[model samples]
Target: MSAALPQVFPHAGLPARVTVYEVGARDGLQNEKATVPTAVKAQFIDRLAEAGATVVEATSFVHPKWVPQLADAEDLFTGLRRRDGVRYPVLVPNPRGYERALACGAREIAVFASATETFARRNLNTSVEGALAEIEAVVARARAAGLWVRGYVSMCFGDPWQGPVDPAAVAAVVERLLSAGCQEISLGDTIGTATPGHVRALIDTLGSRGVDPARLAVHFHDTYGQALANTLAALLAGITTVDASAGGLGGCPFAKSATGNLATEDLVWMLDGLGVYTGIDLPALVETSRWMAGHLGRPAPSRAVQALTKD
Candidate 1:
């Protein structure tokens, strides 16, 4: 049998130090109605780094018609003040997107695939197998170019169009991603419909398949107000990395009723209060979230910000 995972992760007992990948600048702002200026995006990155995000997803190289807000991804990456140890990863949808990211000096990149056939067809316009074949080429090329790659398996917990997703199906895509050389795989709760029970079962099942918990991460949207609870489940499953958006800024545009992602400020606050070192400055994080909210003509969606700002 695989080595027994620590009954109580000392890291957790001593307050786990989770790595939070800030996806606000890219994932959060992508679906916005207003076009967030490239200069604004650059400043946002600077502030996110200052607030202690070691890895910030800066932008996507998706087509303009799909996400016009981030059409100037090249400009956004080019304008950022590059920090020595901090990573600025961008989402590259295909080979063309990968080429654009390389031109802009992207040191790390992310690609996405879905678990359900319906989502694969609807989101990527291909079957699950076809999409994986294409992603294999992309990942191979990216690795050859010496770029760090991350894989996203969306709708892992459940799908709106396809109903309940199979754990075996989730594991199959994860295996493809890992085999294709993605250093880390992030399982996404795309529609925000997952419960803590589902999160636990999926992690355990993936573990049984020999997927190291260390290389796995969770991305949950708080649509049903269960993101934090699901995060706790991930910790129990020995996952230390998570994907959160500053100010809870994004949702699936296809799922109109969906809510924004789990708020970074909120997640950091909980981690900090528990003595978990997220390496993020909570006050500065709140300020950045509020700044983005103001820029978008919306209010910050983080409860921690509301509570902290109220006093």
Candidate 2:
């Protein structure tokens, strides 16, 4: 990305700047069936940072049996060329994972919980309260270790088994994470069933409970092709942080109906057209995702990347 250029949007009540949290290295790649070499993952991180990603989710500290792809979290963090302004956060399932991440010199990390009881049972063989308790323990230790912690509430909009989820249910986990020392909470539409109206309702639920939208982030999937639309709703609702994956590379291992996340390229295209500053170079991101798609033996799923790469 080049020097920051001033931006002025003709639209009213929109933020001038937005933060794109890159999740390609962790949430994106962890769902791949094939193993991506640690070196490739590390290089992916390097390119994302060079492409002007300020916050990149590097890896996870889950057990190898659970998420074999990110089992080498320690090695990946060690080999990474740490950027001065970039933040690399790892995902930890419990205090054990947090301990491993802390030992690896991790400065920031994230813990995930679910809003649906079925998802919690299927994903972790536990209840929502059980998962929340686990993450709370990890967050406590992470805070005491002087590390910044983020929390994720998956299946926020709707669940396949249980159908539409209550906004208050999502807010319960969000508040729990915040009370457990999470500085930011990412609400995820795991199966991509969310629309602009649903996004607003969820944000309103939180806002009514005194949860500031500024400390919230939205992670939407593109299964039904509504990720960007939902993101725009989030932005208009006063959310400044958006989570995306490079090349549209992500799915949930636990959620069978999951799909790739909102592509960073796709989000950047919309934001750029709106005269919003994201400090990201579109061309660079396309080239990087193109390279990644080649390595993964698949075409990049990002509409912007495909449109830009085609002659």
Candidate 3:
């Protein structure tokens, strides 16, 4: 059977290539009610790499008490048969988590931060400034060890408890991450309430604060059915890196209203139509997500995956 593909229609003023950071294994599965086996997580990472994902977030090193779904972090990382030219980054929430990631030989790591105080307190068990302090220490030590570090700022667009976050406030967090030696920062719409204009305005605000758009990545949730539109806005604003999950499979564990991430297949379909290079095979990616959906005992939430896979 022949596979379906998007008709290319090049859009001007957009990047020729965009990096799709695959987060299914880590962020996507972290919120699951049932535990995904360690071996299955390893296989999922391998499948994502086979489908041409250059960067895949493997697992989180946070304590098992916080996120039990990924408690097999050490085993998963140890057992993973890594592919060459593919980068696998792990999340570290504090010094203890960083030590665990370092022990697992992670080459790249990410730290999660919150732009609002309420989110910080709820997610990180600290105030916004306090979380930044911890993240600063982790990033500093990781950089010293010659590992590449990425920073994630959650609730950049809106907070469930504190609605409609200010762009300036998000930029402040971005500045702190940059100052702390993070190579890149992903701005997350945790509750998915952002629109295209808000995305553009936030990028502009970050730029005005002397932060380059190149160092920024967008992580949008599809709660408001606006993830793709907001992503387009980010692309037009010269942001080339996008964070997506394989099956639209992740939501903020701390924030009840935040939905699944912008699906990888859906994002790839859009990029394919736009004539932007992502180097991922759309058919293979769809198949991988379908396989993962079966493991989860649920249908994939990605519209592209659903439409293309329907027989």
Per TM-score, the best of the predicted structures is 3
lDDT of 1 by residue, 233-254 (tens): 8887789899999998898775
Where is model 1 poorest over a 10-residue stretch in terms of lDDT? 1-10
- What's the distance in Å from true for residue 127, model 3? 0.8
Residue range 1-311, candidate 3, lDDT tens digits: 23578789999999999999999999899999998888888999999999999999999998999899999999999889889999999999999999999998998999999999998888888999999999999899999999999999999999989888999999999999999999999999999999999999999999988999999999999998999999999999999999999989999889999889999999999999999999999999999999989999999999998999887
Tell me how candidate 2 scores on lDDT.
Answer: 0.91
Error of 3 at 46 (Å): 0.3
- Model 2: per-residue lDDT, tens digit, 142-184? 8998889899999999898999999999998999999999999
Q: Each model's TM-score?
A: 0.95, 0.96, 0.99
Candidate 3 least-lDDT 10 residues: 1-10
Best candidate per lDDT, number? 3
Q: Which parts of model 1 have CA positions greater than 4 angstroms off?
A: 1-15
Candidate 3 — which residues are off by over 4 angstroms? 1-3
Q: lDDT of model 3 at residue 308?
A: 90
